[model samples]
Target: MKIVEQSGKETGQGRGRALWAAVAVIAIAAAGVVGGKIALKSKVNELVAERGGKAGAVEVDFLGRIHLRDVTLPLGGRSNARIAAIDGRPKILFLNGTLEMTGLDIELPTARILVPHASVEDANLDPATLTELISRKSAAPLAKRIDRFAAKRVSATEVAITQAIAGSEQKTVYRQVNLTDIANGSVARYSADGASFEFAMAIPDGAGGSKQEVMTGSIGQMTGQDFDAAYMARLYTEKAGPDDKEPRPLYGPLSAKAIAFSNGQARFAYDEMRSSGFSMRMPAEPLLETLEKLTSVTNPEELEPEERRAFFGRLLSLADIIGKGDMEMLGLKIDAPAKAGEAEGEKVKLAVDRMALQLDGRRLDAALHGVSMGEGGDYVKFSEASMTGFSWDSTLEALKKMAGLDEQQLETFPFTTLLPEFGTFRVAGIDVNLPNPDTGADSTGTEGYADETGETDALAAEGLMPDAEQEAGADQQTNQPVTSMEKPAAAVPERIRFTLKNYELALTKPFNGIPTDIRFSYEDLSVPVPAKAQDETSVQLRKLGFDELVVSSNIQAAWDEPSQNLAIKDISVSGKDVGSFSVSGLMGGFTKDFFSGDPAMAQVALLGLTAREMKLEIEDKGGMAKGIKFYADQNGMTEDQARGMLTMMAAAVLQQLAADQPKLQGPVDALSRFIAKPGTFTLTVRSKAETGIGAFDLIAASENPMLLLDKVDLEATAQ
Candidate 1:
């Protein structure tokens, strides 16, 4: 179908001529009143008539406003757009146009878009620049050209979109959209009022039916910036390998506020961003500094390899900025029904009533509530799970301490040095409850055990219990006579403090500029104890014991820079049920200066540690002796034989202590006296000279130890 062209001179009828005439008329008007508004309208109507209704009707109102109805504008032979109605004033002199349309629809071979209403105004754009930008084939060139163009104050309202895929349609909508000052730098913002999206997602439903998911959320506002083409490309574009090319950065910064979205089962939102006044400054200072330095060098690649590594090192330091913000979620859940081959009650469901995250300065906190199991018999659930007061500033600073080093130096630097300086990590509340395992018998195996291979505990027991003669022979070989079988000690309750109401760990940076003061504590801690059940695999939580088992440690150590020594002022570990213990020492001659030449060698030199005045105090409530006897009895020995074996072991240990320094005999006698008692005992051991004991001796007891009683200095007392 060809369109006829109308002009001052009669033109031939053809699609090309028709399009050219229409463009020429608009261009003339844009070029400043070549053909009057009336003439332009007539030409548009003429082209519409020539299209034989394929192009809808065009009319000119008395007020010189162009009116379009059911207008179909062809984009070559591939696609076209249908405008139900268009009413607006077109300004040619200012190269600006304002238009409003209703029922605007676009059609393509595989897709279609519909817009109920759209209004664009104050759009000042240069035609030639737009033509040049669109003509470019590559993104780099397109972005570069876009840098020269600017458009402002363009807004659209109520946009509806639909995408077709494999016989299904996915729909999305936006309530309002705006573009402000797009050019070298521009901002774009959009908003949606609890927009609803619907889609059919394929899932493993019992009947193989697609699941209908509806996501509803109010996208309050989202804003983004478009800088220059090169900048944006550098920030967002990624290229692969030999075929890849460096890209220019385009966008600047992007932010979203009060953003939320959720399908029926899961919900995600940032409700706190608005209500809690959340704001953050991303750590970018180090990166900015590095880039600023590079600006003086025409090409950063031209710099030396060492300089390049230094630049990269600086960039990584920016990651320590430590943002502060708050986030939250509501009604998040996951559900999966039992499959055909799965057992009953095998379905899984996990739900959380609410979850929240908060960051203030260097501290990070999180909270969870109404946490419950939806499937698998609800074994574990906690009404609340909260973790608060954790600081990262100290840790980051410790890491940054190595920032200025070269790549090789950094590789050898001990990153673990930063581990102990995490400032403080605290969790004030964690209350969890777990029920007994299921006990119903199944065809697979016994109740609760659920062994698929038909294996039973009796089979396992047979392998564990040896014949009576074999047991007797084992004891006889060791020359240890057993009067009676030793009842096994009860399993110690887990020390994890699962019902921990509060916990804390901290390593403080002293005012003296050295790592000092380490503190750890646990309060209101308890462990669950399970009772025997008919099914070996299942046990019911009969009671909670070990209550009020408070444990605390406050260790203070300092470096004497002049003497290159690490002085331990105090180190203690104490608990309510366990005896108190303390250790103090002077770790002399650390050789910190000797390793100053190389970081790698510095780590090695740290091993050259010598200590003096090492002291230890233990206040035991006769528990140590009982523990020793119990352990020996487990090895098939009588109570008397266990005590005799323990005495020899103690004497053997003292020999090693005396070998390091004979003066340790005093502490040796003190230990002996404490071991001989069956009541409360207090034992104290101190290094007689400046060199109290060797590190290896204290850590790994010595062999072939030499003991001398003349230089002993120790004390032990019993009550």
Candidate 2:
């Protein structure tokens, strides 16, 4: 309606005309409100439909005001929307809306999770940009591209699909979603029926800082085809903004089915995973930074100069740990403290698998099978293990390269290169009867793994030694003899050393609460002795030698918790070159010196011995070892008349062993005088009986003289 007024300018009485014109203006404003309402109502209706709303309503408030009421946006449900703001802002303005969105509660799977609470103040949200990326990422082909080429190369079985759950304020196009902190908290749970996981996570108040959110409910199941890279390129290319023509590849595709994680941990399933070798210029990751720190955690330079060099070498060894290494079990168990319930790391297994690697040009191929990615992120138990095949081709090639030899020439060398430290591997017990590389027999060295087939044979011993020269005879004994007789049988050299193999040990008994059955082999050890009277006196050490050691020793013990008396039940031992000897003496009547001036006779002197492979178990249960036997001049003993004093000679030697002496007795006491004052040609120890005087073997089949080791200059080396 053309309602025109305000003719006050033409009216002479302007005040009166203005009043009439104001009334006209008010009348026109009332009608204009009706028209503005109609236009705004149409606008609101269009917006509701665009937002998937149905049966929406609009209302106009006082002057130039409009309100939307009970406006529902349909996601298969009904809701309301309200918005209010000034037509043209002069100073302050405000707009607010409350939404109660009921989620799609279909046959969703159930899950329980506890999420730590966190928050952030500034998020710098780019609703528009984020929306575009999200839209692209959620595309059936694009998201599928991420899902398809997701594993480097697509598997015939496995596929991934992602759909928009709750999109950003604007549509987004992403090559692959970098969920960032969201990815940190979110976990994927899926099965092998080509069903990808579709989950809805509660967005945190903010993305970073202390912000955290955990959702515990079934999101959805995805049974769609995976998108390929070509699809991703095509999808993004079509949606590409003004300058998106360059087509940047976001996250690189995976070359292997496994997801290689931080700290060198990896996880993968066998069938569903597709792997293709691809070079990844791994853009700097936080994990790499962390591992670098670990590599330098214990600085080699922290050690002393000489020690530092060795430490540095060991640290360098760890650099190629993924290539040339062995499995050194640090630990395995349930509820590992590190990483807690998260996936268990693959440190040891990877090393073992890498043990057989060879650098063929720049690429490395394992001579053995690659380690299987463990089923569960586990520690103690391995449900599945990788096995290796027999092929020494790489080893042969390495040898040929080094020596420039042909196959015929290489044949001259031993194919089995022995690791001196590792020794030789020989099967002893339960044999898997695996064919040998050379001998091709069950007797050949072979291994049996737990997961595969036949029962495993007992693990074999690893080291073997070359044959040694047998001791010629008692005459072969080293050192000078006192009476010039053949060497003592007890003085034979049978080298001994300790055997330390990994053996399952258990407590059998305790001698004085010290655990027994702590058996160990002692081989290739040497002991020495001295010549004596009657039977040769010697240190018998036939229980230690150069072969397999079998030791059984009982400690000084008692039935009660605390007891004074200590008795050794049995300390039996067996070795290839070792013999057994048992002896016992009462620690009675404390004396300053045993064979010196102040000495007491042992009431019970006992010792038993059995010669090598002989039934000669001889034992001597007899007289005390008098410090010295003297021959007095003519009838009785007078200091001046004694030309050769036996007691003095013996005491002199005994005093060297005994630090202190309280008394002296008999000829043994007299022998101390010579030792106390040296440079005297007194009675020397003899291996045989002298024409008028004598000394004899103490502990040997053939008596021999004692040569003191203290007198030898041990630093000598032959030219």
All candidates: TM-score: 0.47, 0.19
RMSD of each: 15.4, 27.0
Candidate 2 global lDDT? 0.28
Task: Please write out the lDDT profile of model 2 over residues 1-719, one tens digit for every residue.
Answer: 22324454445568778898999998898777677667555655565666665433465544434444443443332323222211210111232211111121111112211111112112221222222232333345433333322111111222222233444121111121211111111212211222222233332232343322222111122221222334234432333345533323222222112211121222212221221112111112222333444456465435554455433343332222222222211111112113322345423222112222232222333322222222123212111222222233334333334243344865554433311111112111110112323222232222221211111111112222111232233224654333222122222211111222212222223332223223222322222221211212222121111122333222221122232112223233322222333322212122212112111321121121111110111111110111111234233765344434654555566765444322212223434443333222122221121121111213431343123222211111111
Candidate 1: global Cα-lDDT? 0.54
- Candidate 2 lowest-lDDT run of ten: 609-618
Best by lDDT: 1
Give the backbone clash total of model 2: 47
The C-alpha lDDT values of all candidates are: 0.54, 0.28
Best candidate according to TM-score = 1
Identify the runs in model 1 with alpha carbons over 4 angstroms from their true place.
1-85, 90-98, 103-114, 120-157, 161-171, 175-190, 198-326, 330-426, 436-498, 503-522, 528-607, 612-719
Give lDDT tens digits, candidate 1, residues 348-398: 666677777876666777777776663343334556666655555555665
